[model samples]
Target: MIYSFRNSGFRDPETGVYNQTYFMEVFNREWHRHIRDHQSLALLYLCPHIHETVKQPHLLEFFMKQVQEAILRTTDLVARLNNNSFALGLFNIDEQGTQIVLHRIEEKIELFNLEYGKKYTSHVDYELAGYTCTPARNLRIELIFEDVESLTHELEMEKNKHIELRQMQ
Candidate 1:
C-alpha cells in the first residue's frame, strides 16, 4: 500500500518513506501531544553509508528499505531527510530508552551488512548519530521545535567539521 498523506511533501519517491517535511509536521503534532499528556519523545538522525559503498541506484533503494524496516516500530515514525540521511521520531521514550533503541538499530544494520554485502556486490559501511530531548512543560512547541532544529543543524556541522579535519590529514 502507498503510505502517504494528502499534499504530503515528506514522502520520498525513491524509498516511499516520509521526507523531512513530514517529519517536522509529525514532530510538531507529537510534541504538542506530549506537552499536553506529559509524555516523552526522542529523535534519531540516521546517516547511512550506502553512498560510500554501491554506486548502483537500486542497491541504495534496497538498503533504505532494510534500514527503514529495521529501525521502525509501530509507534515510531521514519523520514528520509535527504540522500543517505534519515531521521526517526520515537514517542514516549526517554534518553536511555532512545539509546537502547538506537543500539538495536545499529546491530540490525551490522547484521544486514554481513548477510547481504557480498551478494549485493557492494561494500557496506554505515554510521549513526542521534540525540534525545524531552521538553519542559513551560516550553512552547515552537521553541522545542526550534531547539531540535538547531541541535540537528549543530550536529551536522560538527560532523562536517570532523570530516574536514580528517580530510586535512
Candidate 2:
C-alpha cells in the first residue's frame, strides 16, 4: 500500500518540516535500506544558540530556508524534534559529505549576518551535532534520539576550542 505522510498531521505547522513522529517512522526504514545497500546514514541536529527568537516570528522560517538551501538534495529529510531543535536525515551520505553540508550551513549563516548583522545587532550562532552510521552489526539504532544530548555537548566543546584558537591567532 502507498502512503502519504505530508497530510497525516506529522508536519510541523510553523516550519513545514516533518515532526519527530514522522521522522522516526521514516528514519527506521531508511536506516535498514541504507544498511542493506552498504551505504552510510548521517543525522544532524542544527541548533541556534543565541538567536532572539521571541522577538522575531520569522526566525525559524529563515533558519529552515538556510538549511534547505545548504542541503539542496531531494533525498534528505528535515524534521523538527520535541525540543524545537531540527534534525536532518541524510541517506547515503558519508562523513565528508556531512562536513561539507556543515560548512555550507556556516556560509549561509555568515551571509545572513553580513546582510543584517548591524541592523539586528545579533548574528546567528549555531551549534551542530552530527552522527554518521556505517553499515555494521554493532551499529545502534537508538543513538539517534538517545545520544543527542551528549553529541551536542561535544559539538559545543569543539566549537569553543575553535573560538579560542581563533582568538589566540
Best by lDDT: 2
lDDT of 1 by residue, 1-169 (tens): 2545663565777777777887878888888888778777776666656554355666556666776666557778888877866777888887677776766776666777776766766555544555455555676655543444455456556644311000000
Once fitted onto the true fold, the runs of candidate 2 whose alpha carbons sit more than 4 angstroms away are 1-8, 50-54, 157-169
Each prediction's TM-score against the native? 0.71, 0.81
Most TM-score-accurate candidate? 2
lDDT tens digits by residue: candidate 2, 21-68:
989899988888887888887777777664445476666767677777
> Judged by lDDT against the true structure, how good is candidate 2?
0.70
Q: What is the alpha-carbon lDDT for the whole of candidate 1?
A: 0.64
lDDT of 2 at 67: 75
Write out the backbone clash pairs for model 2.
none
